[model samples]
Target: MSKYIDKQTELKQAMIALRQERSQIYDELKEQVYHTSEYLRPSSILMRTLKDFNKEPEYKTTVITSVTSIIGGYLSKKFLFGKSSSAIKKILGIGIQVFTAKLIAGKMTHH
Candidate 1:
């Protein structure tokens, strides 16, 4: 009867230890989940994407091409049809703008 009591006590202590370990593991998993959620947020994802983009070797060229393209497109429109109110002229102006932008961007990228 005494040996039975000792074995029961040992088993109880082991269960308590196991419960503590399980609780600790659960807490760790919860913390990891929280961190993962934070990382996956939209703003966080955008920031990470921007950071990766900035690290690329072509980042400077890409930025310059985009800025130059927009400027070139706007200037083409302004120069070709400044303050024109004709529907045909407006459509042609938009087409020229897109063409100019694409041309400038393509030339810049090739260089």
Candidate 2:
């Protein structure tokens, strides 16, 4: 009967230890979930992206190249088409603009 009592007491202690461990693990998981949610928020993501973009020189170069290409394309279209009212001429002008932009951007990248 005494041995039986000892075994029961040991089992109870083990159960208590297991419950404490489970609680600690649950709390840690909850904390991790909260942190992950904060990190994944849209504002957090946008801020991180902008920070990285500002820090990188390559992004600045890319932006400049893109803007210059677009302006060059616009100028070429205007110079060629003037103020034409023909739908066909307008469409052709747009095609020429795109071609000019691509060509300018490509040349800029190579040099």
Candidate 3:
């Protein structure tokens, strides 16, 4: 009877060890699924980009400056330019305005 009791105790200890191992394996599989799952992977790129955009202060400003320069150049060429004006002159004008705007913005941001 004492031998049977000892055997029962060993079985119970083994079962507890098995249960703990199972729990750890379950957690590892859950983490693997989260990493390789299709639904999470595609959206993760956008999420990461948005996260980076939110985290980085300079990225948004740089994009805004580029877009603003392109729009400004187009507007200036379309409205401020005369039909008879040379293409080279128009381009130079746009370049000058964009450069000046960037310089002013840089100065403002620095101060």
Candidate 4:
């Protein structure tokens, strides 16, 4: 056979190999895309979220801290300043201060 004929034969084989490889790559890509779509379905996403929730402490800490803080606030407000005569004296003092401020503002506006 001539050299030109052999070169043409080699080019044809190379082109055929390249086309097969391209088709294989396309099939692999399509398969991967289908698998990815299945992986991201709603049920799959929910399962993934549940898995992550089991692995994290966000919900636990949020519940514990929220209840503790609310109870602590109520208890402190009720117990810190108990119903004693001294507490009554403090409340009366605050009322006097507010009354004096209002009297002063009224006098200023009168001028």
Superposed Cα deviation of residue 73, candidate 1 (Å): 7.8
Q: Using lDDT as the measure, name the better of candidate 3 and candidate 4.
A: 3
Whole-model lDDT, candidate 3? 0.75
Residues 14-91, model 1: lDDT tens digits: 999999999999999999999999999999999998898889968878988999999999999999899899999999
Residue 17 alpha-carbon offset, candidate 2, angstroms: 0.7
lDDT of 2 by residue, 1-111 (tens): 999999999999999999999999999999999999999999999999989989998998898889999999999999999888999999999999999999999998898
Count of clashing residue pairs in every prediction: 0, 0, 0, 0
Question: Candidate 1: where is the Cα deviation over 4 Å?
Answer: 63-101
Whole-model lDDT values for every prediction: 0.95, 0.96, 0.75, 0.69
Q: What C-alpha lDDT, on a 0 to 100 scale, does residue 54 get in candidate 1?
A: 83
Which model scores highest in TM-score?
2
- For residues 2-106, could you state the per-residue lDDT of candidate 3 as single tens digits? 999999999999999999999999999998897778546868878888899989989988777666656655665555554536878778777766765676556
Deviating ranges (above 4 Å) for candidate 4: 60-111
Top of the candidates by lDDT: 2
State which candidate, 3 or 4, has the greater TM-score: 4
Scored against the true structure, residue 1 in model 2 reaches a CA lDDT of 100
Q: Model 4, 27: alpha-carbon shift in Å?
A: 1.8
Q: Point out the worst 10-residue segment of candidate 2 by lDDT.
A: 57-66
Using alpha carbons, what is the TM-score of model 3?
0.39
